[model samples]
Target: MALASLAAASLPTAAAAVRSRVSLLRRAMAASPSSSSCAGLAGSPARVGVVQMTSVGDLDANYATCSRLTKEAASAGVKFLCFPEVFSFIGSKDGESIKIAEPLDGPIMQRYRSLAKESSMWLSLGGFQEKGPDDSHQYNTHVLIDDSGEIRSSYRKIHLFDVDVPGNMVYKESRFTTAGDTVVAVDSPFGRLGLTVCYDLRFPELYQCLRFKHQAQVLLVPSAFTKVTGEAHWEILLCARAIETQCYVIAAAQAGKHNEKRESYGDSIIIDPWGTVIARLPDRLSTGFAVADIDLSKVEAVRTKMPISEHRKFDSDWKTS
Candidate 1:
């Protein structure tokens, strides 16, 4: 299917109308506290880092870039750091991704786990090319690692990028990647986080499900968005998700040319619940990270005033399992 068709099909009906309703913000607004992996750092502000990169087919080189960025974030006192999709490697040749795919417990991931432990920080390894069921395919997995270096949760990419760009560029991600059937949410000191990959940002219903069903207070969109689409829809789509879901949206992105055939739009950004851009890289092509403080109070404050969850009249219509 075409990109427009896929987008139109995935989106739910226009958001439900708001009704007059009042409810407890903490109790009624966000994800279940019980579902969180750790205690909520309620009153405190947690610092986060969003790393942007220009990854290529070289695994060792990418690892080195990530290490430098991680050290910089640690020096800035960031507690949780996010890396973009294809953080480990972006293939420059056909069959390279599938050839290099590894399991979650493989050496590549283990190295990243060690990095998190050594840095004493939580890590969102956005997209790893996990070995799939066959020799020709892989799973684009988004993994969350705790500060203790244990795997917290993993979400595979549900929405694949299979679009035809105007500039004679066509992507068929499904050709070599399997779509994930699960929606994953996990607890962190920051809040309950909804994990999604690059193309997933185009769909609002997923974000709604996160806010309503999973009670996600923060959303992670780790992407290697193409330069064309990123320039057009990336930030706007991110801000829309933040405002509509009443959640913080953290996007770590791939910037600049990765290989001869591909280039990414870099502008790693953090948006607040009110649709405000809090932190973004000034130089979009720079291999660096952006820092911001995640204030749960602000998340509560925004949802309390709006109370969209309680006021939504078509709750049954758009609710997802």
Candidate 2:
């Protein structure tokens, strides 16, 4: 459809965005009229912030950008802040990724830990290049830090994005990135939260296990999605997981062209249980974030109303017996 014709379709979406913003405002007001922090606001479970970034090969530059954004999130009373994948660095070539890979407790994490401590905000380092066993491949890891600057949980990118698209667009993540074997969930003030990285967003089963089996209230998907794929599948995939799991979906994304080789799509978003895109950052390439108030009550409300997990027909669970 032409741009004018598309307006009709966007009308409802515009209305929905308004509603989401209003809902967030009301929730924020209810918890604390003036404060945005969990400490400042007594009753709120937590106020979360999601960041969208244009990261490049320069590690110091990326860190500086992240630091500025982190300060902005803290100023807004964001108690929990999540950043896009490859927050530490996004190199020019595939091989350069392994070169910059660092250990979990390396300087990168230490600096992020300090940021978390300074802001008094729980930080989710969406995706980092953690040094693997050999130089051949590194692990795309997600590290979770508590407000006190302690590492809480870390999940490696389980499903690598290895695809050969038309127009000679080819990506072999497995070429330099090792895959993770286990699913991970962590406890937070808000509730149990499940963690996953970019390509893992493509698999619904991972989310199913996180919600139904692991009992997660929130699902995290930190991505550096390709522009083409992200434009086509980003929102749909996010809403699907939120609706099916009845959990809040928090996705932080990398935006803009990182180098000559790659460009990312970023409409960094946080969707509610009923598949409503409650909060979203700009679709254009830039650095920004969207904050949302997560109420565990809403999770219970949605699950109670839909009861999809309770009504499953077949068992997809593993039996040790």
lDDT of 1 by residue, 134-236 (tens): 8899999999998888999999887777767766377888899987766788888888899999988876766777787778899999999888788788888
The CA lDDT of each predicted structure is 0.82, 0.78
Top candidate when judged by TM-score against the true structure: 1
Off by over 4 Å in 2: 1-45, 315-321
Candidate 2: give the clashing pairs.
none
lDDT of 1 at 266: 92
RMSD each, Å:
8.3, 11.5
Worst 10 residues of 1 by lDDT: 1-10
What is the model-wide C-alpha lDDT for candidate 2?
0.78
- Leading candidate by lDDT: 1
